[model samples]
Target: MDQTVSTVIDEDVCIGCGMCVKVCPVGTISMKEGRAAVTGKWSLNCGHCEAVCPVDAVRVMSLDKEQSAFGTFDADHRWLPHGEYDTVQLVRLMSSRRSCRNFKDEPVDRPLLEDLVKIGVTAPSGTNSQRWSFTILPTRHAVIGLAEKVGGFYLRLNRLAEKSWLRFLLRMVGKRDLEDYYHTYYEYVEEGLMEWKQKGRDRLFHGAHAAIVLGSKPGATLPKEDALLAAQNMLLAAHAMGLGTCLIGMAVEAMKRDRSIARFLGIPDKEQTFAIIALGLPDEEYQSTAGRKLVVPRYFEG
Candidate 1:
């Protein structure tokens, strides 16, 4: 292999968990002394291996590239009556949001995350109950721990379905795969279930810089509409921060069923966990589209 193009795995940092080995696209890496050991000239084709090393053991040559994408958007020019530019800016923010699932390995900063949470508080709640709470889940270790427990439960249920004649019947009804996802489907439910499940969760929460679990008391004075409104506010604030968010559904559903997860979250039995979201800087880019069609419910427009 060319010394100019090389890879290094920090033995002390690596868990020797073999995730990267399974995820390697070219299959050039293996574990040695419970740590990742690169082998074969295929190691020469080892770019993918460096992408998902959760522990940062695998050093990629390009990881050091500077990322300074902050506050690049501008729209101060007035284009309409009243707060024209600012109104346009509001439209812009909404259109920019996407269900992001890709994220970098860097941990989200706590202070920044709190700022995002403050924006969440602005959302309206029924009768001012404001019954919403946000919990941030960071770190691969915590994600893996959650995935293992949840994934085990799902895998076991799936196996039970397979053993029964119902497995054959489910195909007809649309209960495809029976399991939540075949492999690497849910970072919190699927650890190494994908064909390359062993590789790593380089993209958990879609690599979002942070994660949020938003919920409200089961029967709080706040209306159900309040909960949803609050989540939308949080989402917009994250997007404006140059952060992408994936509104997680299935994984949170599993947590709802599993009291153990709720316990970890520290929610009292009286409260219910609602919308969950993952936050981070977006890796992929696309042009923006605005929902400015002006669909007024025309009450007899003269």
Candidate 2:
């Protein structure tokens, strides 16, 4: 394998800003004229320079590896074995799976919904243990009802424990920053409550025509893994079928605290909803990923 790889910076958006050069803790970046250049043959793969740069001008192209590591989609989702998938296409599909908080007030096709679930059923579980179950909220009414119930559960827990000291201590996380962490989701939810109930575009369920609630065995070694895989599969399948899906993280966070949620979702007492996917036919089409903060590695070697 090649010891060093090269990451290129897009000169256009670079703005000749040395943010990348300055932030490179490993001294792996250098200034080239007015542009930022990657140094050391990418011997240091840390991407702090690229991440800190205001303009998205950095590209971390891995050497001796697929150049599409930073982008590209696996259409067939063969990122794993035992499944014939297009690894590149899957990456695109997964990355494109956006958190759609606003959705069209429409219903989903039943057969297509069934097909999506079938795709999830094929996801590998822990040690091949299929301890996963799914509940589909088929109608708009039901989706709202479930979300409302889950939201109530969240507010109650929000008042519970005084505050999370560990997360705060480790990362200087404040309470407000801790709660409603996902892009004004709580505010959106609160505002959408009335509109969703009236079948308006509150998009409380992110405009999902249907939602698949995932359940797993408590204390099961692979519960979270199995549930997440199933959710991913479902999201991709929904995307492939010309539909959209969003994994509702807050729902899972709330459900983990409420033991009765499983029962509410028709899951057996032994099962818990580890994930919930909001699915629906897309109202509009979009390409390209919204700007996202680069995922920076903690440190580097060589």
| Candidate maximizing lDDT | 2
Candidate 1 per-residue lDDT, tens place, 88-151, comes to 7797788888778676666666656666666676565654445576676765455555555556
Instruction: Put down candidate 2 lDDT per residue, 1-302, tens digits, no spaces.
Output: 12354577787777886888776755567888887776655345444565567877886664223322222233342235456668789788777877676667778877666666667867776644466777888887778777777767745544432255633553454445544343344445555554655655544466566888888765456788888888888777677677777887777776777767756777787777778888876666667866678998787676
TM-score of each predicted structure versus truth = 0.57, 0.56
Give me the displacement of residue 112 in model 1, in angstroms. 1.5
Model 2 / residue 82 / CA error / Å = 10
**lDDT of every predicted structure (CA atoms):** 0.63, 0.67
The per-residue C-alpha lDDT of model 1 at residue 207 equals 46
